[model samples]
Target chain A: MIQKKICMLGGFAVGKTSLVRRFVSNVFSDQYQTTIGVTVEKKCVTVASQEIMMVLWDLYGEDEFQHVRDLYLRGSSGYIVVMDGTRKDTLQTALALQQTAANTVGPVPFVSIINKADMRSEWEIDEHVIEQLRDRSWTVLFGSAKLGQGVDELFLNLATQMVQRPPLSNTHP
Target chain B: MSSDSGRSLPNSPTSEGFTSREEDWTQLRTLLLAPEQTQLDELRERLDHRMVHSQEVSQVLPEAIAIRGVGDQQLSNALTPYVENGFIAAVRKSPRAIVDAIAPIMGPAIRQAIARALQSMTQSLNRSLDESLSIRGLRWRLEAWRTGRPFAEVVLVHTLRYRVEQVFLIHRETGLLLHHVATDAAVVQDQHVISGMLTAIQDYVRDSFGASPDQTLDQVEVGEWTVWIEQGSQAYLACVIRGTPPASLREDVHDALAHIHALHANALADFAGDATPFKATQPYLESCLLAHYERPPKQGALKGWILIGLIVLGVVWWGWMAYQAQSRWSHLLDRLREEPGIVITQARSMWGDYHIEGLRDPLAKAPTALVIEAGLNPATVKMEWAPFYALDAPLVLARAQSILRPPESVQFHIEGGILVATGSASPDWAREAKRLAVLVPGISQYRDDGLVTASISALLDRINRTVIHFPSGSSTVEPSERVALDTVAAILRELDQLVSQSSQRVHLEVLGWTDATGPPARNLQLSQERAEAVVAVLREKRLDKAATVVLGSVRPLDQGGSNQESANQRVATLRATLTAQGQDSQTADP
Candidate 1:
């Protein structure tokens, strides 16, 4: 069995915890997020017939007043960056957090998710930005924590990438 | 270069031909640096072959290790695993060789351990046995019952010094549980989560307090439990202890953590989520699960002694009471045996009770009364007395007394079956006793010889004291003489009544005396006539228990010089005596 440490990073209220909670209910309560700025959840997924346990470190949403701690990204094998499609500012926050995670944990596997896809009619972020991110070789996908859409794929795609790609550095910083 | 040096260089471009100049220059270069080059080549070869370098490393390894060990613990930390693995392999390959190698050292240690164990076991056994029945133990049992805990647990709670209930060896980086060991009664939870929580809490404290990473949360106390955490390079050991843990306990935890890291260095360093390799670290974690209980107080033994003292006192008191009861029972049996009219056929004591079977005369002493007299409970003794006649003197006397129903004035006893009646009794009672004594079962005859009849003597005295006086020449009855004659007649009647009950009779005599002034023949005839006159008067009154006697001039009634004496001599005196009924009254007169 292989275990991968996955960090969930996003702007405040981007449904990062909501995405984890919708995918698997095995998560600490939201109160831990307020106190420790991180709540860990675990999910086991089979990628290429190999059972990979992904230990998810759901970090508190980054905002203007609070920034995600670099210490939490020490051992991340992969990460997921979430943004709210209704708020363009949240999309910018997700992009900035992705740079921080990449710099901290090195260029490992990651996926950018535009959450709240169920409210696509009210979405402010256009598909052109997601198309540009895909052209930059970044995996970008649409997800909705409310409708439970694309949450499983969002986690499993990262898990498959982590399992197939050999880490360039040690597992832990 | 000098000209001489130039001549020694054969490959110089000027000396040699142009074609061989390059080769000559090469030769000249080799000739100049050959020795130095050879030294450098040898040094490079020595560096290239690792075996020769290893030989040199081996020469300095032990000294380096010793020096590094003296400087710090890193050398020991690096070598502990190798030593442990080597030892384990050696023991696994030939346990006997290892055992034989350490025999001299292990033998005494094993004997000492066994001896100490035996001593400890014996002491504990003695203590438990002593306290099992003591008052303190009873109180502990009561506490156990009240609190719904085991008695041993209650005792342990009171005597506990310190107990490490659980030990957790957790990964420092991921906060995942590597291995865990706990005491038998400890409550185990999700060790992974617990380990994570412990790490998070420690991190929280560190982050909250702005403490350095080296400064860890070593201990966390909650109520009676203290979680002692010892940080290692790779993993940390956390033990939950109940009670005041000694200072050495921290050292032990530290040592256990260090030993686990030493033994499982790679496993801990490369730990992801698989904890299987860390399972072998259970013994090290288990070694941290220590418990110490103090010996119970000597007060338990003291309570046992007090209980023993009370028991001894109770037994002594019981024994004394039993002895007293036995003594009384024996005394009662002895008295029963000594009793005359009671014949003991069987007597025995069973279960602190007595049963006696005997033949007793109706007149014998009652056995129940004897039991009360012996100061014993009457209910404790059962008596069966059969009726029988006893020829013992007392019973015979009692029988006679019962049958004869003699008066209080008479005392009857049996002497050889002859019922003897002593003490004076009325003639009527005496006569009745004579009749009934012969009828008694043990009496052959009745003896009243010692018995005096009071009524017969009274009558004889009255009859003898009576007298009558006659005038000198008168032979007739006068009024005074008639009164005297009447008293004599009544006396004679009483005497006859007293003598009528037995084969006896009363005889009365009347004697007449004359004065000495007349002729003898005339006086004799007067005396005779006087006596006849008295008799004739008594006979006229029908008093037949009488005989007449005359004293004439041949006998003087009185020798007085006065004429009154003469008048007194003319009296007739009455005498009464007891004689056989057919005896002649005239011949018996005196």
Candidate 2:
């Protein structure tokens, strides 16, 4: 079995922690408590008849904590940059975080997850943005942690990719 | 020595009493100089201990648990025994009892220490009162004071006493006790001496006023009275006095008492020491002071006018700021509107070659300009100009050229400034050719006759547009032409509204013709089909559908000299006829 270390990163209160919780434990918390540091959880997924372990790291979501994000991304095979669908600035922050992670992890696969998908009426994330990111060869997933929608599929897809291509060397087992 | 003066020898007890009185007077003098010193030192020590203990407690305990202080009830309970035995005289006591009993028991040194302590305590209390009694604090204190018992009960009582005496002094010439409280139920033994003092005081006031002794007499009562001298009715001098004097000689006594009170009050005003004349009345004086200092009621209309003025000024200021902001925003928008091309160019630079559809040179010439113009860069092109149909094909073709390259083998035929081009190219190459055709200047029309041999799917789009048309007289279309016809219909509707309204009835005529390559009958049929195609669109536009008759002119019969001329001859024409109804007819072409 192959295991992939995947980190979720974004700005403060953007629901990065909730996304991981929705994926791993199938739970959502509405209360927004600032994450002190980083939280790690694991889930096993089966894709195309192959077993893959996804070790998801839910890092603290604050611009101030961005300096330490690379350390979390160091052993990761991929990342999911989360942003609130209602806030455009969070998307920009997520993009910056994604770039930082890519630089640190040496071209690790990444996806942009526009969370809070239930709020489509209030969504600031436009289809043009998705097309642009997709053109750049990064997957874009719109999801809602509260509804538990698209959370599992996002992880499973990333896990399959991880199994097919291992992370850059020097990653811990 | 007494035998020559013929007075009886005084008893030992009487002699002792006289000597004791003399000793008492001496002690009083000493006590007055150092009154309450010991008590004051003890109080200072206790205060220091309390402060230190409170600091320690505050350090040890949580903020919520720190104790405030002993309550008044508890303090009063502790002092009850001393007070009962006459050790601690109530504040109501006369100056005599205060001097005699208190001085002997506490001693001059202790008395002095207590007085100093009390004085320092009073000063500290006053400082704290000044510090704590800010307007807000005083408001809160007053509210609490009114709602419940006074929070500072002891201080309030002391203040009351001082204020009452001050009031009494203000009315001193009236010979009335404005305020007083009895220290003991029983009268003092020196009644005669007090009476004699009253007589002397009355005589002094009568002399001062130059009034007869009997005429100056006024109301008299025990311990206080009022006297008046006849001057003017309002100008008469009234005196109020306090302390006991004889009833039989009360009229004379009232005059004296009035003189004494005025002298005492004046003396008090002149004295630089801390003691206030207000303190003479004891417990009721603080209330009097509060009443004396109470603020007068504010005028209603003045306050209301002030409030209105402030509100009006605020509204004007806000309105001015908003107006300025709105003007600034509009100015920025106006600047943006003036440079449409620049804005589009900037957007293109920011986003790169993405959804910018018609990225083309605007100087291009081509026919079916509408479809070609649709291909122009949506990002780089702003919707600033009212689009002319003649420019559409040229603009679109230019855009297509930017996206795709044409094949090398493509050729062109130019006749009378009209260029005809055809080639077998890839779908991409055909798109590029269309784009290139649009870039050519003065070319009015185009036909997509070139074949895309490699992809049937690519040619399907062009086939679809050519086959679509509107239903009839409604400006709406058949389901097949729904999307494209809707866009055209919207433009036509806008044009219809934009044209002059006073030109009477507008008549639209549809004519159709066909190519000369076919047999006569077939060419005639093809021409009819072309004619119907245009008539159908006119009918759908709701533009005089009855007037929109299809005129079929077969190709060879109507052919011009060259293929370009012949193609022009094969064109469909939709003419608008304007009838003036009651006036002369005026025709306009759109």
Candidate 3:
């Protein structure tokens, strides 16, 4: 089985932990993120007939007071940036965290998720912003953790990308 | 050198004329120094070909390393990080493979290390014990006070009072379980979750305190369980213990963690939730699953023997008491059965007391007194004796003597079922004894062969012999005959009193006889009057228990030949008799 470490990075209260909860059958509680700045969950996803064990590291949401620790992002094969659709500034935070994840783990595969898609009417993120993320050849998907929409696809897409990509070279020392 | 030569070659003119000359020059060069050029070409080819270059370097690398190693430490210093990193990477890739490859080498070294560690631990333990009351002890006490640990806990730690119940080898980076080993009796939860939580807690402590990454939370205690975590470069071992662990136990745990890290470095580094690779660490982890329970403090030999002696003494005392009670009960029962006039029917011991129920003659000895004689408490003996009359000879004779109230001169004895009397008693007593001897239960008969009556026999003889004279052909007594009749009446009264004292009655008979001086009818009438007159006088003297008989000329008192003799026959006589009260009388004549 192929194993990949996937970090979930995003802004504060952007439903990053909820999205991981919606994706993986986890034994650890969400309070781990609040306490330790990271919570790890594992799920076996078969991508294109290959069993890929994706170990998801859901990092505590970064805010003014706390920043995502680089220690948690070490050895990540890919990452996902979660943005709350109701908060446009969360999109900027997600983009900024995506940059930090890239610098920390070095050019791994990543996907952008605009969460709360079920509340489309309340979405503050515009199509242009989504378009700009797409223009960078970055994969941007819409999902809602509460509604369990696109949750499977969000994690599976990252797992498949990690499996198709080259093996990680920038792992922890 | 390759970079310098490549730069020179590029600058060496790559035009068409230069290219043709280059080939011509190469041919000319090959022809002039063919063997040398062949050697040069081979050299160039070996440098150009990756495989050939690798083979060439492989051939020389050993010698070069050997030479450089002997010359200085520079080669080793330069290669150390790469070798270390490569080793780390290899272990990370497949720890099992690395362990398998190095097992032949690591086995003895690990054993030696373990032996050394064990020896060290033993020495430390001995030292701790030796220093328990010395200066080190005072220091330990001070440490306990400073560390806010109980003195007992400190002592237990020194005494090695703990068992390593479980060991968890966890991935350092991902917080995943690498492997777990536990004692058989340990309660195990999901090791994966526990590993993650342990990592999270460590991370939380570190992050919360802003401690350096190198600093780690080493120990966690909850109730009686303590988790001691030893951090290594790639992985950390967490030992779960059930008591205050000894300092050497932590040291041993640290050694085990270090061994596991050295052995499974690559596997831990590359561990991605596939903990199966870490199974090779089982022996190491299990080794860390050590236990050092403080043995009960050794007791002095004298003290132990004293304890056993006391217990034995108690048991022996109890057994002796029981035996004594049982023996006393048996002896008491035997005595009771042997006692005369006592019949033992039931005997048993109940509730620490001897209960005896039997039939006992009232005159028999009390069983409780026998209980005392047997050296047992009377209160501990219960006796239920139903009164019975015994046929034993002594008891029967006693009964007879008690009932008859014989005089001192008379002694009663029993032979078999017969009550015999010896010596003389009053006739009243003798007669009364004859009647009442049958009342004693054991006496079936009464014998008085040797017994004599005291008074009543002589009195009877005097009364029977007395005679009263009457005048011829008259039914009256003279004054002298009356006096004689009064004396006989007094004798009769004495006999009646004696007989009355016994269960007997007395009777008297009076007879009148006539001489040949009157006709037969007149004589009979005269005799009848004389007897009636005698009886009438005796009746006046209170002798009413009498009867009259007249023998008028039919039978005279005497058969004499003269009238004077016949005149003596014309008399009133008295006869006396005695009989048992319910029987007919027997005559007594003198």
* Residue-by-residue lDDT tens digits, candidate 3, B327-384: 8888888888788889989999975877888899987776777888999988877888
TM-score of chain A of each: 0.91, 0.90, 0.91
Per-residue alpha-carbon lDDT of model 1 for B1-590, expressed as tens digits? 43454566564466447548757666886888779779988899998998989999999999988887545334555777899999999999999998899999879868966875686577567656755886777988899999999887777677678899999988776666678988656778756556766776776677668788899999999977899999998788889998889999888888888888888888776665567798788768877888787775678767868989999999999999999999999899889888888998998887788899989989988888889999989998989999998888898888888888775556777778888889766778778778778888778888899887767677567666766677777777688768877776755655554555565776655666688667767877777777677778888888664432223222444554467677667766665666675564323222
Give the per-residue lDDT of model 1 (tens digit) for A1-173.
65566788988888888888887773334342442456766767887765777777777788898887666676577899999999999978887888888888788899989998989999999988888888889899998887788999999899878766754444533
Sorted on lDDT, best first, the list reads 1, 3, 2
Residue pairs whose backbone atoms clash in candidate 3: B91-B266, B91-B267, B92-B266, B475-B530
DockQ, candidate 1, comes to 0.06
Candidate 2 chain B weakest ten by summed lDDT = B162-171
lDDT of 2 by residue, B388-477 (tens): 222333344443344334443344554443445565545554565566664555454544675433432222222223323322222233
DockQ of structure 3: 0.09
Best by DockQ: 3
Against the true two-chain complex, what DockQ does each candidate achieve?
0.06, 0.00, 0.09
Each model's lDDT comes to 0.76, 0.49, 0.76
Lowest lDDT 10-residue stretch of candidate 3 chain A: A26-35
Report the Cα lDDT for candidate 3.
0.76
